[model samples]
Target: MITEQKPLHSGYGPESTAQEIVSDQDLRGKTAIVTGGHGGIGLETTRALVGAGATVIVGARSVDRAREILASLPNVEVIRLDLMDPNSVEAFAKAFMNSGRALDLLILNAGVSFPPELKDARGFDTHFATNYLGHFQLTLRLWEALKRSGNARVVALSSIGHMIGPIDFDDLHFNKRPYDKNISYGESKTACSLFAVELDRRGQEYGVRAFAVHPGAILSGLVRHLSNEDLAEWGVTRNVDGTYTSSGGFKTVEQGAATSVWCAVSPMLNGMGGVYCEDCDIAEVVSADSQLQYGVRPWAIDPTSAKKLWDISVELLNIQKDTIPNVGTNLDSDRLLNVSIEEPVVNGQLSFTR
Candidate 1:
């Protein structure tokens, strides 16, 4: 069933911090994987989850950097995983699954915005590839671990940037059109939202649920590429005196992580999935002014678009996996879409134990 895309009036708001949400929750034996878990709001998310007693594996492209950021944090392990590299992603997943641990929480919290480049090793657009495809491949690779947990929750860190536009499937790599950083970021984020919906549709029956979250606008490393002029344009509404004030609705790192943490461990959301959440609550649909800032837009959660993006991603991955004939992937999306891809391209011989 589609979860109602409306707020439950969660007692939390934009000012709520990650620690405040999980204060009373005990996650003693829970195991989680947080991509990009070393910096920005991702760091706060890791802190809160670990504080609640969950053993978290931080997937990082730079193991040294992750170690530096998470230095001495108990129950947190830093592993080398690059979202832009498929080989790295597969290797990380195989290592994790073969370790005999079930993943109870998978947070797709790492993403980039306004990158200076257009493509990666595979010639795919970096924003779309990193933000959406990397997470897609990782989740599929770890499906069995999530299923075995019997109560897994996958959270995708979507953004209000999704309101900027929906995805243009044909031009995902900017092959035909000119590349605009803002539009590309928006496309990647929209894909993130769609992935959650489709993932929940397929995984809910296996006791796994997925949700997409808009963490609200926060000053983080995420906007590294935004020039002062770009920042100025974005801050036209708020009093931008060299920094973001509360009037701009910008959140601190702690405040930004509230919704992601909420979606990951909230009992109030039990049995609900495929919803877009903000401010620590399931958001409402935008029914009035198109300029509404809070509610989820119609295009972001459209089931058809979600499935379409899923198909396109599978097709793209199938093509990318073509080079790796040494390993095979368990493309078991067949359960939901009746499309079976036993493509022999993964580096490991691991199987998805459906």
Candidate 2:
């Protein structure tokens, strides 16, 4: 478990925009890659990073489309990357690695929800493959480039949906169990958090840090697959003029991308890693029964589960374990057997203390 999963009381809140977070930060020589960077929350993130002087490479499945969308952003490059296709992922990684440019930030921002039921070529659930495994492979494939930076941060865009449940390892692809779209999405997001936990543990020694961010709920391209009825259930209202209004605590795209930007550039987070964040601050660890929709759940940050998932991912990706540096060979049996989390009341408030 991440012992430091507690809020920093960062002055920024739900309304803070990504642009606001990075407005004064200087990233002049940094290099960043944002998956799905040309659209929605990712587009705002890319804009903010570029505005701060970082040269960003936007990875999109459609190169021309991405270029058209990002043509106005200076210092932003569009590259072909289809997260659902392993071959495409490999090709993209190879191209980036061949450039020999160190990677300073990697934002795994692309994801899907409520899409038609499907599977990738490997027969894995499309949700799991694209949202978690794809980013998992990309991070490992670019490990060398990340290491070259001597100070790199990888942000996995998880969600409050992670509170839905932990990864169902026994039936990750819903092979043996009945498939529920919401459950599948939740599990995939949980995997994103677990990936951050394990990646931070392994990568920290090599100057790489990882964070999982729950960009607040927003009406963005991610909701394209949903019907008007679905949006209505989520508290979206149609105006007289036909413009949609989000009233269920939904944020603007800029606000939605704020946590990712804060994770990437905030000096307040300089020494922290492997923690889940929200609203531009480290999130508290909440119990599964908690009604609050903001904090991270214990299952998402369990070190044992994190490592187990990491190994499973490596096997699924067919990557040689030896190729990855600092891959832990043994798991502490005590830690595995006795995973305990305690929340203490401090100043009349529920505070998680690991």
Candidate 3:
């Protein structure tokens, strides 16, 4: 029950770009996994990491689209991963592990926001499954690779939206109550934060660290479900040319990627394990009644709640303590991941878990 919350004032802020964060660092020989690395801030994060000489692996649903964005980037590999499908998540993890590479940085950067009311094949909320559950499973499956890396970091892409979440454990799947898309999205981010808190506690002993990051709002495809008017409702602006013009104060994608890059490679955070970060620095705890949009909420970083979420996730996946196999020492790169997910979500049926 010890606290791992607090800000260190490392001196970076909203204006910092990913390029600035890694200006003084070197990631040569390092290997990283960035989910959704081909899109939005995730793309910028990939650029930063690989620019520093890291070999970056991405779990992408559309390998073609991923290649289209990153074909020119060296040391970048794309594998099939549909975050909405548990089977694809497992295959991606298996493929990555089978490569026999030690994972130095794992950025769980893939996420969805503000989608229409939808449920997974398991009947779990689509936002929750895609944003939280899939990442949780992938991280667990890759735990050994991280530990083998000797000093690894896992950054979970959480958000300020977590402020609206107070997990309804009894009705987590929105089974009993009417569903609210925003609330479900918030709940998913909250789960991401809690996962990092608890994962850090467990993995710190193994030289692996975890962090939850709030990449500032940007007009990424994360909001494709919204229209121009819907975007305006949330302070996002779109131009007539089908591109974002401005967002009340949304950061550029490069700026949006700064905190992740900072958390991944900055020496200032060497001793830190679990913390919620925003604007390129550790965030301060805010009171529930506070009017400010910044700062981390106590509930989002609560250790008790973190443990509860961990247990729930473990149970949902039917994973036993020994389920994580030890395979980081030897990889069979000759094997291939079956890329058979023609449609990740089809006919309102989700087949995420076997």
Which pairs of residues collide in candidate 1? 327-346
Q: Indicate which candidate wins on TM-score.
A: 3
**Weakest 10 consecutive residues of candidate 1 by summed lDDT:** 345-354
Q: Candidate 2: what lDDT?
A: 0.82
Question: For every model shown, what is its TM-score relative to the native structure?
Answer: 0.87, 0.89, 0.90
Q: Each candidate's lDDT (Cα)?
A: 0.81, 0.82, 0.81
**Candidate 1 residue lDDT tens string, 48-163:** 99999999999877678789889878999987777777777777787887788989999998887887756876789888878889898888878878888999999998988888
lDDT of 2 by residue, 123-197 (tens): 999789889997887787788878889899999999999988989888999899988888998999999999999
* TM-score of model 2 (CA atoms): 0.89
Query: Where does model 1 exceed 4 Å of error?
Result: 236-247, 287-289, 319-354
Instruction: Sort all candidates by TM-score, best to worst.
Output: 3, 2, 1
lDDT tens digits, residue span 1-354, model 3: 333467777888899999999888789999999998988898999999999889999877777879998999999999878776767776788788888889999999987787778876677788788889989878877877898899999999999998896688998988898988889988989999998888888878777888999988777667766777878877777667667766468888899999999999999888686899999888989997666789888888888999899888877766654453222233222222223424343243222110
